[model samples]
Target: MPGHLIRKPDPCIYSQFLLMQLNQPVTWDNPDVRILSGGVEQYTYDLTADTEYTVEITVHNSSRDKPADGTAVSIRWIEFGAGSQTRHAIADRVANVPIWPGTAIVTVPWRTPATPGHYCIEVELAHPNDGNPTNNLGWNNTQVHAAQSPVDRSIRIFNRYPRDCPPVDEGGGPYLDYRRAIYGWGALGAIGALLYAHVGHEGGMGHSYAVSVLAFYAIAAAAGLVFYRLHNERLRPRAAVARAATGGHADCHRVEVTVDSYEFDDATGKDFHPDTVFAGRTVVWPAHVDPPSFIFQPGEAFRDVTFHTDAPDDPGPPGHFNINVRQGGEPSGGVTLTITRGG
Candidate 1:
C-alpha cells in the first residue's frame, strides 16, 4: 500500500505575493526634458558673447494615465566642462501635460555671458506626483564649430578640485630623457673617436683605417641627431599659455588634445541591423600632450590652452572632425567641427 502525502505551500512565495499586493508598482513616467538652440532644432551650437538668443525647452509627459498640470520647468546655463560648474539661471516656466503623451515648449530669452567661451545648457522638470525624478533633468554640453584650413581654437582649463591636481603630461618626461640619452651617446661617440685616433697612431694603423673608424662614429652621430630632430618636430608644442588667477601662482599643466575624423556609409550595416556603418576613421592627430604636464596651485587656477588643425587640401569625402580634450585621464570637454563637401 502507498501513503498519499500533501505538500505544504512555501512561506516565502506566499509572503512575496502578499507584499506585491500591498505595495504599489513603481513606474517611470516622468517628464522628458530637452534644450533646443535658438530658432533651430539643434540642441547644441555655438553662441556669441553678450548676444541675446531665444532658446526653447521642450517637455514631454510619457505616462498615458497621468496628466501633469502646471509642471514647473527651469533652464540654466553653465560653463562647459566635466567638473564643477557655476550655473546661471536662464528662465522658469509652467506647462500643462495632457492625459495622452503630449509636449510643451517653453521659450526663454538668454543673454550670453560677457566672457566668450563654450557653455552648456541644462533643463529640469518638476511635478508633484512624478513617478520617477531621476529622468527629470537633461543636459546639452556639446558644441559645433566650422572653420577652414589652419583652424585655431582656444579653450580655458581650470583646476576645479579642492586640492592641487597635476595635469597629466604623457610625452614630456620620456621625451626629455630620450633627448638626454641621445646627447650622451653623441658625447661617447666623440670621446671614442679621439681614443681611436690616438690608438691608431700608436698601433701604426694606416690613415685609411683611421678614416674608416672616424666615418663610422660620424655616421652613427649623424643618424642619432636626425632621428632626435624628427621626433622633436613631431612632438613640438603648437601653442599653450598658462596664467594663474589672482592670488594663485602660475603652474604648468599638460593638455592632451586629439583630433579624429569619421565617415559614415549608408549601404553598410554595423553591429545592429540598419545602422549605418562607421567607416574611414582617420586619426588626424594622435593623443599626445605637448610640454608634458602643467602644475596647479593649491586652490583654483585657470590656463589658456590653444590647439590647431589643418584641413585637407583636396576636400575629400564629407566627414566630421572631433577635437577632444582630456585632463588627468578624464574628459574635460570637446567640440565637433563639421565639414560638408559638395559634389
Candidate 2:
C-alpha cells in the first residue's frame, strides 16, 4: 500500500465474487433450482385453461450433464414469481410436454385460462426414481418477463468520464489556433511588405517578426488537426447517469437501450430475456429481432440488449435488476450500437 493505489479490486466485482463463492440455497427449499444453461437461463410459465403457453427450451451448448442421471429433461411448471401474488395463484397447471436433452422443445399452442393468474416457472431435471421423486432432475427455475423496468446502472454500464480528454465546448472553444493557421504563414508572404519597410531602414525588424509569425502559424495548423481529431473521437457520452421512460403506448414492444450488460425477462415472467448479464459486457433484448447472436453490421461492431430479470433467487444469484426502454416496431434495418468501456 502506498499514498495512492493505482489499480485496486472493484468493490462491486469483489462484492459479487464473494457472493458467488458463498454457499446458499438457489432454490426455494434446497439447492433444487439452479441455472445450468447458457444465456438468460431463467423463465416464467403462465397457465390458463384455454390459452397457449410457449416455452423455448435451450440446452447448455456444452455438456454439464452427469452420467448418473443419464438424460436430463426440461419440464415447465408454474409457481409464484418470487414475491408473487400467492403460492396457490397458479395451482399446479403443468404442461403436457416433456423436453428431452439435445433438442429444442416448445409446448404445444394452447390458450391460458381467462382469469388472472401468476406463477413462478422453473425447469427441473427429473431422473429415474433412484427413489427421489422430490428431486427435479431438470433445470427448475423461474424467469421474469420484459415488462419490468431496469435498476440502477451506476458501476455496471456507466462509468465516469475520463480526464485528459480535451474539454469540448459545444458552441464555442478556443479559436486562436484557427486564426493562426491561415495567416501564420502570412509572415512568409508578408516578407515583401517587411522588405519595403526595411528599404526605409525598418525591414530587418519587420523580417524578424514575419519569420516568427510564419513558424507559429505552421505549428498551429498541426495543433488544430490534433484538436479536431480528439473532439470527434469523443463519441461516447460523458460519464453521467440518465434515465427515460417509455410505455403505456401503442408501440411499446420495441425498446432497445444501449447498456454494458442488462437483465431482460419476458412479459410472462416465464422467460426473462437475459437471466444473467455478466458485469462489463453489453446485452440487447428482442434478441430474436437481432438474429445470429451478435448484432454487428457492415460498418460497426457491438450488440445491445435489454436487461430482463425481476425474479427471486432465494440464495441471492444476483437475481436481477434492470432498466427498461420501450422500443417501437421492428427496425427497418439492423443497427449496431458501439459502447465504449473505458478511455
Candidate 3:
C-alpha cells in the first residue's frame, strides 16, 4: 500500500483594499481621461453630454500585501444635480487582475448621462482584507456641457464680456486707458492760455489778467490744501510689525501698543485723529488724554501687532509704548517693527 499523500499549507492572502494594522492603505492614485489637447491629467474634464469617453484610474497597493491573481476592482460614477444621482458599476470588475505592492492602471469606458450636468467618478478596490476604508476610495469631478452641434437660435447666452483686447474708441473703454489724448489736449490748452496771458499783454492791460491769474492760483492752492488734508486723513503709511513670545510659555498672551492723547491713525497713516487707533485692522478706539491702548491677544507666535502711528502731521514716533504679555512685568518676546514704505 502507498503512503498517505502529504498536504500543503495554503498561502496567506493579505487584503489591501482596507486599512490594516499598518498605517498606509491601498489607494486610487489618479483618475483621469485624455480629452484635451495637451493630454494633462485633470480632475475636472469637459465632456459633451450623451457621448462616451474612456476613463482611467491608478490603483496603488500601499500595504504589505503580496500580489495575488483574481483580484477585482470596482468603478462607479456619480452625477451631481437636483437629486444627486449615482450610477453603479460603471466598470463592474477587472477580473483575474494581479496587483503587487505598487500600482496598476485600469481603463474603462464611461458614457455621459443624457442630461448635461456635473458628475464624479469613483474607483474602489474589492480586496476582502482591507481594513482602512478611508484611503481605499478615490473620486473625480467632471463638467458636462450641452452637446455641440448645429447652432440653434433658441439657445441663450447667460454671460457676456468684451473679448477683443483693443477697444474701437467707440466712445468708451472698459477702463481709463483710452483718455490719454484727452488729458494731453487739456494740458496743452492750459499752458497755451497761460503763455498768451503773459506774453500778449502790455503792462497796464495785463492787470486784469494778473488778477485772474492770482484768483486761479488761490483756487488751486485751496484745492491742493483740501486734497492734502484728505490724503493725510485717508492714506496712513503702514509698517510691517510682528510680535511673538520669547519665553517657552504655553499660555496665550496679549500685546498692547498705547498712544497718549490720540486715536490710532488709519493703516495708510494718511489720516490721524485723537479718537482712532489703527491696529491689525483699521480700528478706532475711544480718544482719551490719559492714553488709549490698542490690545491684541496672540495665541501663537508671529502675530501681526504693528499698527499705524497716530501722529497729527505724519506718522511720527509712537508715544508711550507698552508690550506686556500675560499681564506680567514684561514679555521676553517683544515686538519688532519695520517701515513698509519709503517717505
Candidate 4:
C-alpha cells in the first residue's frame, strides 16, 4: 500500500424507482384511442409523421414499499443509428406517481427520432432504497417507417373467440340457423318429390306437388349460394361459434399490426434523413410479440414487419376490430391510429 491513497466517500445520491411487475399486462396508455373525424386530435395526428406518435407506457410496482405520491418516472426515447455511431436520447419524460403500483403510467411526448429506423423506449423509476436498482430500467424496440399516405395501414384480425370459447360445442347461431334452413328446404323438397313420384294423384295434383318441391329446392340452392358468398372458403365463424357456446357475443379483439414501408423514393418526401439511407436498411422487430406466453418470431433471414394474433378467418375487406399490440419483453404502447370504414 504505497502512500495509502485516501478514499473519498461516495457522494452520488440514489433511490430505487418503482419496480416493474405484471399486475396487469402493460400496454399503450390508450391502444384503441380513435382520433375523431376532422377533430383537433385527428388534425394533429394527420400532420405529424409516424415518429410523432406519442408512446404512453404503463408500469407496475411489484415492491412492497409504496412509491411516494408524485415521485418521478423517467422515460428515455432513443434511436439506434447505423453501425456503432453514438446516439443520444431524443426525448425524456418525467411522469409523477400518485402511489407505488399506482400511477405507473408515463407518457413520452416527443416524436420518435425523425430518422426512420429502430428505436427504443426506456422507462426507469427514480426512487431511493430500491433493493434492486437493476430492475428499475427496462426498454422496448420498434421501427419507425417513412410516413405513408395512410399513416397506419395496419391489418386487423378479429379472433379472440377461439381462445375464450369453452371446449365443447362452440358452433351454432345465426350461421347455424341459415345452414339448418338450407338443409331443411333441400331435404323436404327431395322427400316430397320422391313421395309424389311413388304415389301419384290424378289430374295435375302430382304436378302441383312436384312444382312446390321444385320451388323449395330452388330457394334452398339460392340460400346456399348466398351463404357461400358471404362466408368464403377461408373465412370461419369463430366468433359466432364462441358466442353460441358462451351464450354471449364473443369479444371482437382486433389485433392491429404495423404496416411496413417498402421503399424510400422521391414519392416518400418524409424520408429526408441525410445521415441515413433507406436502401438496404434493415428493421429490427421485437424478438417476440407478447413474449414468454405468446411469441411471434420471424426467422433470422426475414425481418418481422408486423405482429398479430391468429385471425379467426381469412383477411377480409378492411374493417375496424379491437386491436392490441404487445411488444415482447416490453410494455405495450398505444399507436395513434385513424380508423375508417375501409382503408
Candidate 5:
C-alpha cells in the first residue's frame, strides 16, 4: 500500500482565517473633541482674536483586540454667524489610539483670525478602514467673552429658520386667535345700535342716545383696527411668540438659561477650585433663585439677552463664567465670559 499522503494546511490560508475571526468593526464615535483656551482643566474658555490657542482631539478605541495605530484629525474655524458658515482650515494632526480603554489626545496649535468677533470651531477624523464614519465630525460653536466686574454682556440668540415658533404645548393648547374675538365684539356693537334705532325716541334723549351709539361703534371699529395691526405684526416671518398664556393671545417659545462660574489660574491655565468649577454664579439680573426664561416671537430671528453680574467690591481671584441658553433641551447658543478685575 502506498504511504498515506500527509498534507499540511497552507500558512497564508490559516493566517487569513485567524484574522477574520479576530478582527471586529471599528467606529470613530468614541472620541471626544474640545477647544482649550489655557490648560486641559480650563475646559472650554473664550478665545481672543489674533491669538494662538490649542485644539485638543482625544481619539478613543473601543476594540480590545485591535488597535487604531494611526488616525488623522483635521481642525477648522468658521466666521461667527448663523446660516451657512465658511470654514477655514486650522491644522491637521495624527494620533495613535491604543487598544481597549486607552485614548490618544492629539493637540494642535491654532491661531485665531484677526477679525474681532466670535467664531465656530470644527474637528474631523479620518481613518483608512473606518467602519462607521458618521460620528467622526464634531462642532464647538459656543461663544466666549471677557469682561470686567459689573459684567454687562448682551448675548444674541438667533433663530436661523425663517418661520414663527409657537410655545411648547403643556397640556392645554398654547396658541390663541384674537382676530375672531375682536370681530365678535364688533358684531355685538352693531346689533346694539340696530336695537336702539328700532325703539323710536324724540328730542334730547333721542339725540343723546344716537350720539352714544355712534360713539360706541366708532370706538369698537378703531379698537378692531388696532388689534388687526398688532396681529399682523406677530404673524410676521421669523417672529417669536413669547407672551404669557394669561396675558395675551400670542405665546412665545421659551428657552432655559444657565450660568456657571470658575476660578481660573492664568499662570497654570487651570481652575482654582476643581470641585466647584461648574457652580452657579450669582447675577444681578435673571435672579439666581427665580431665573426668568426667554421667549422668541415668530418674525424676530435675532434676539439679544442682557445679563448683569455685580462682582464684589473686592472680587476675589480672577475668574470666568459661562452663559448657556437652551430651547427644548437643545443648546441654542452660549458665551464664556472671563472676569477682568479692574485695579
Candidate 6:
C-alpha cells in the first residue's frame, strides 16, 4: 500500500467510456391509419423507427360498386403536431386507378425530426376508392411512434445500447445480477493480481497466502459490474412506454379526429361538431370506429372515452354524449362526447 503511487491506469477504462454512449434509445412511429368509405382495402405493417421504412395503401371497392375499367386516385400526407394547432398536410401523390380493387404505397422517407419525439403520419385519399370512383376521396392520418435504445451500466465493463427500447429479456433474476457484477470485478481483479505479483516478487513470498489477495479482488470486481448493468437496464423502457400510452403531450394540448359526418336527431344533437374536439384540444373523432359502448354521468372526469364505459348510466338515452378529447384551443384534458340517448 505504501508504494501504490507508481501504479499505472486500469486498461478497462476505455470500456467504461464506450458503455456510456451505447445505452440511450432512439425514437419510432406507430403508423395507425384509416380510409374513407366502406371497402375491403387496408394498410398492413410491422414498423420500426431506426430503420428505413415504407408504407403501402390499397383501395378495394365494395363488391356492389365497380368502376368502369380504370379511374383516377391520389394519396396525401399530413403531419399532426402535439398541441392544438391545425396540423400541416403535404400532398404526396395522385395516380390513375390500375386495378378495380387497387393497392398503392407512398414511401414515407426516413427523415428524423430536428427535435427528438414521436410524430403521427396522417394519409388522406384525395381520389375515390375503386367501388365508387366517381365519389370524391378524403384524407386520414396515422401515427409512427419511435422505440428507445438500451444502456450498459455495469460497474467494471459498461454495456452501451444506442436506443432506449431495452431488449425484452434484459431483465435477469437475482442470480444473473450477481453473475454480471462478479464478471466486472474479474476485470479489476486482474489489476489487483498484477500489484500483488509485483509486491510478492520483491518480498519473495511466492509460496504464501499473500497470493489469496488475487481471489478477493476477482469477486469484488465482478459484483460491481453486475450491479451496474442491472441498474441502468431497468430504466430504458420509460420513453417509448409514455409515447405509446397517451396522446397530445404538447404544451397546449391537441385533439383532432377526421370524420365523414355526424348523425343526430334534432335536439341536443343539432349542435354536435365532428371537427371540434370537445373543449377544443384533443383529437377525438375521425368517426372513431367501435367507440366504446357505455353510459356517462353529468360530473365525471371527461378526458378519456375509455372511462365513459365506467360512468354511471344516465336517466335517459337523450343524454348520451361522445367526442374526441381536445387540447389546442380549449379545456386542457377534458373530452367531447357524442350523446346517443339520455340527454
For TM-score, the strongest prediction is 5
List model 5 lDDT by residue over 1-343, tens digit each.
3322322111000011121123211111112456666675333425567877787776666456556666777788765432223579998877777764677778888887887777756677777755444446555544333444456666556654326544443322222334433455566665667675667642323467667566556666667656655656656432333344334324334566666542222121244453343233453333221243655555656666666776555644544444555554444444545455544
Global fold similarity of model 6 (TM-score):
0.25
Worst 10 residues of 1 by lDDT: 8-17
Evaluated at residue 148, the lDDT of candidate 2 is: 26
Candidate 4 per-residue lDDT over residues 234-276, each given as its tens digit: 2456645655795453322222232222121211136655333
Stronger candidate by lDDT (2 vs 6): 6
Looking at model 4, report the run of 10 residues with the lowest lDDT sum: 11-20
lDDT of 4: 0.36
TM-score for every candidate vs. truth?
0.44, 0.24, 0.30, 0.29, 0.45, 0.25
lDDT of 3 at 285: 24
Worst 10 residues of 5 by lDDT: 8-17
C-alpha positional error of residue 307 in candidate 2 after TM-score superposition, expressed in Å: 15
Ranking by lDDT: 1, 5, 4, 3, 6, 2
Local distance difference test, per candidate? Answer: 0.51, 0.30, 0.36, 0.36, 0.51, 0.32
Q: Between prediction 3 and prediction 6, which has the larger TM-score?
A: 3
Scored against the true structure, residue 211 in model 3 reaches a CA lDDT of: 63
Model 1 residue 341 CA deviation (Å) reads: 6.5
lDDT of 3: 0.36
Count clashing residue pairs per candidate.
6, 60, 20, 10, 16, 84
lDDT of 2 by residue, 1-343 (tens): 6513332111000111122223211222112222222333223332344544544433221122222223244444433221111122222222222222222233322234456653333444333322223323222222233232232111111101111223444323446434543455343445645555556644444456556445545555666556654764453233211112222222322234321233211132333233342223334322222221222232222233333323232332233222222123221111112121211
The deviation in Å at residue 129 for candidate 1 is: 3.2
lDDT head-to-head 1 vs 2, winner: 1
RMSD (Å) per prediction: 24.2, 23.0, 33.7, 25.7, 23.0, 23.6
Per-residue lDDT tens digits for candidate 3, residues 213-243, read 5544555445544444554444332211111
- Answer with 5 or 6, whichever has the higher lDDT: 5
